[model samples]
Target: MSLPSADADWWRNAVVYQVYPRSFADSDGDGIGDLDGVRAHVDHLARLGVDAVWLSPFYPSALADGGYDIDDHRDVAPELGDLAAFDAMTAALHEHGIRVIVDIVPNHTSDRHRWFRAALAAEPGSDERDRYVFRQGRGADGSEPPTDWESDFGGPAWTRLDDGWWYLHLFAPEQPDLNWDRRDVRDDYLETLAFWADRGVDGFRVDVANLLVKDLTEPLPDRAELATRTDGNHAYEDRDAVHEVYAEWRTLFDSYDPPRMAVAEAWVPAHRRARYASPESLGQAFNFDLLTAPWDAETWRRVIEENLDLAAESGSTSTWVLSNHDVIRHPSRYGITAAAGQPNEIGYIPAFGVDPEITVDTALGATRARAATLLMLALPGSAYLYQGEELGLFEVVEIDADKRQDPTFFRTGGERLGRDGCRVPLPWTSAPPSYGFSPEPAAAPPHLPQPAWFADLSLERETDDPTSSLSLYVAALALRRERAAGEGLTWVPAGPGVVHVVRPGGWHCLTNFGPEPVALPEGEVLLASGPLADGLVPADRTVWFREA
Candidate 1:
């Protein structure tokens, strides 16, 4: 496949910043972030030089599935504000030269969704009922779940509908999987895409995109044989038919004047399945290899090499993410722990089994955290910065049982606490009340004070301080744009744990993940996130050297 012309593929080198709207910043004091809140932060993102902002699901929902179970695709959630606020946000982002990409969940809709409600109320075998997958059991024996496969949140993947049939729920029971086989469903999705496109949304960060279509006849794959489980939800993910769905979406998107990019959240290994996101299909797929790659020189080299090779073979731009709303925060993932007596050994034990008050310290300190940020920003491809990541925020240590909101955490008998730790509110100020998120009354009665860490680390205090993480991120982003590293980069293998990335213009980036100083073949140090004198000390340190 020939590469798209450089002028035509500007998104190939774009950097996307993801915002979990609920936690970003609250403008109306509803104790929740809203569209207006997002508008308030657009300037900050613009100054940071991100190419686009990907807002996680802000659509109307019952809040059962953390906005993934969307009830209305066209309207914003009431808590997030109304259509007018959304328009204002779009305008603000565009004014700052930042594209806006909202999340689109096409696979399933909240059971409360009007479509699902109507489908349930309709007689079986009726056209409305046919919109969703409804199957009768082969007697009492088959009435249970079709397979032993568990939902990503745990328990059976199938839920018994009030109409006496079973419906598949790849994630939560409240989220009934839509029957993509139904022409109505497919048409509805196309219309939804058009609706947003007409609204000026530049693109979409498709959620569970690979699960949009499923093997209607085959039983769910056995979990034991799968290579990996994402959020513990693999029973119905990555069916080959998903490719067809993506191709259809790609065609629809191409019909528009300026082609809209679709970024899929696929967990397939980068090298083995890069073709899934070929130009003919979706524009890009998330690169989990970088997120889960071992913290070592050789591992990093192999992963990047494989990724680049895959990109070359598939002729598709790669997408990289360090953390998102669904997983543990990267700082907690890579930070060293003193309790573990090793670097980058933080354990993300949820508040289920352990004593609610237990605290385990990680050895990774401020320096290591800084290094990780530098490496993430320096990487080539579309970098996804999770909301609050720029502030060097760590994972929330304590989550009360009542405070827990993730369905995955509750479904797994508390085995996997899900993503509640990372989904906590972003701290905009140090003052105690509401953490400056919103003035709205707390969702739960007897509003609780914002966590203490918010005071310890906040954007208000750090944004202007040169030594703060927020300042560092701003500076790095400025450098990234000024040097045009946001453009495609050429990877040159230097040695283990050290690689030279040549970006557009005359810029060069050298990354050393090892514990010892690396000798640059020839360059002058432009920026160093760790002890430059030591070459490259491990546990989160990156050195950028430019050709003199």
Candidate 2:
């Protein structure tokens, strides 16, 4: 009912909702969400019963990669409002007993950032250029990139400027990677961390936490033919030196009275993930297995067990996430494919149903999505939820190709549709136009066009129906808080493709992942993701019960 009854360690088991500022609720009729938008909706989070809110980047930026290309770590974007608006939002969240987890993009900076501008203006090897990951091109006349590492957004990691030198940008060309080896870069972040903590932020979600330090000591190899690897031995990503970066952050953030917490977006292999969340490193490195797991029971069970085990190994609580701003919404994903297969690699990005020429069954996706929610919430550890998921929002894959803005879309030359679908503005009211995302005289057409069908799934419509997705989320969250599952998990062999788990307090959660009906273990049905039929546990359904 309040900030957690527990100590500062609340994040260990918190349900931190992720808010993508561009799409959440827009105030001032800007058609773009702002700090004030979040301020007005703090009660929505509080009523949903989440412990905290993890806000996506709202910093000043060119938005080259949708705000991941941050220009200022210490200042809020003028469009989103100034520092005063951010402070007001944080205060409002605190008033509603919700923790604020601001995103920290230490991996890269927008090309428009002052540091990058100075680097470009100064001569090669100058102090300004040294502050970033800039290097002279290896080829004669400097035509070729320094290395062959591919940018996550697309093309070569190095973007050649007018100068002979090329700067590294693991993502879009507009987002130049920072030189973590530089003392100035490291020291500069300390001030940024303190600036937000002083503003009463409870924690930070470190972006690209594992790729800070690069292995630029040697002649960078051209990875033109190299494929993506998940194993932790990358030249730049998940490097051993990156772990030290988080450790320093831990010490710096701990200086705060309540001691701010941090979660790393490190996309390392299973074996190496614990290092990032160990006692000395960032408090929790995201456990992405669940997000990438197949909808089958065996896979979900394994993901759950492995995540919990790894958290124990590191002496940190596990974190489970279904979807985020960058990925396709779970419901749409569940509908797109009958089976949820493994990811292409460690940091594989889903193309939002664009990869395959198939139509998604939205009804089926919604059913399984509700089941997936129960399975995740019943597990022991924290859960990260993206906004709009609670409203059963599906990916808007049909948005006109011309309306797409993701750098991935342009950089990949339309091969990938990018994340524009899932980032559509939230539908607050059922009407057309802004749908309550913005007020009258809407601003800039919502950044991305909202689908017409959104009116059917608006919060206003859902709240009127008890069986709506929003209603289910509220009820499930209430039960989750009331009967908190303990740190223990025991799996009962409930036949193939059925995972029945019993946590402490005699609570059991059973999910039937197959088409065949599975007999329920003797218990009282406390909650079900879907309607029960003939007292038999239906396939593709999940239910939480108390053992008789």
In terms of lDDT, the best-performing candidate is 2
Query: What's the CA error at residue 91 for candidate 2, in Å?
Result: 1.2
The global Cα lDDT (0 to 1) of model 1 is 0.72
Per-residue lDDT over 1-548 for candidate 1, one digit per residue giving the tens place of the 0 to 100 score: 11222334656768788898887877766567778889988878887788889999999988787789899998999988998998889888888877878899988999989988998888878887777777765456556665556777779877876656787788898998888887778888889998888777778888877777655555545557444654324445666666777788889888866788778777654443665668878777777775665467677667766776677677876666667787666666665343334333222344422543434334454565566667656666667888888887767746777787888777877777777777788877776666666654645321223577787678788877877778878778888766764436677767666655677665766666666666654677666675555444343567666777
Candidate 1 Cα errors over 4 Å, as ranges: 1-8, 138-143, 218-236, 336-366, 439-449, 485-500, 504-506, 518-522, 534-539
lDDT of each: 0.72, 0.83
Q: Name the lDDT of candidate 2.
A: 0.83
The regions of model 2 sitting more than 4 angstroms off are 1-6, 224-233, 338-356
What tens digits encode model 2's per-residue C-alpha lDDT throughout 1-548?
12443567888888999999989998988779998999999888998899899999999888878888888888889999998898888888888888999899998889999999999899988999988887888766879877777888888888888766788888988988888888889999988998888778889999878888877766665574234544555677788888777778889877766778899898878888999888698888899887677678888878888888899999998998888887778887777652454332222244545556455788988998999999898888898999999999988877777887898888888777778888999999988897889987775678788888999999999986888999989988888888875678887767898988888888888999979888877779999998888778888899999988
What TM-score against the true fold does each predicted structure earn?
Answer: 0.88, 0.95
Give the clashing residue pairs of candidate 2, or none: none
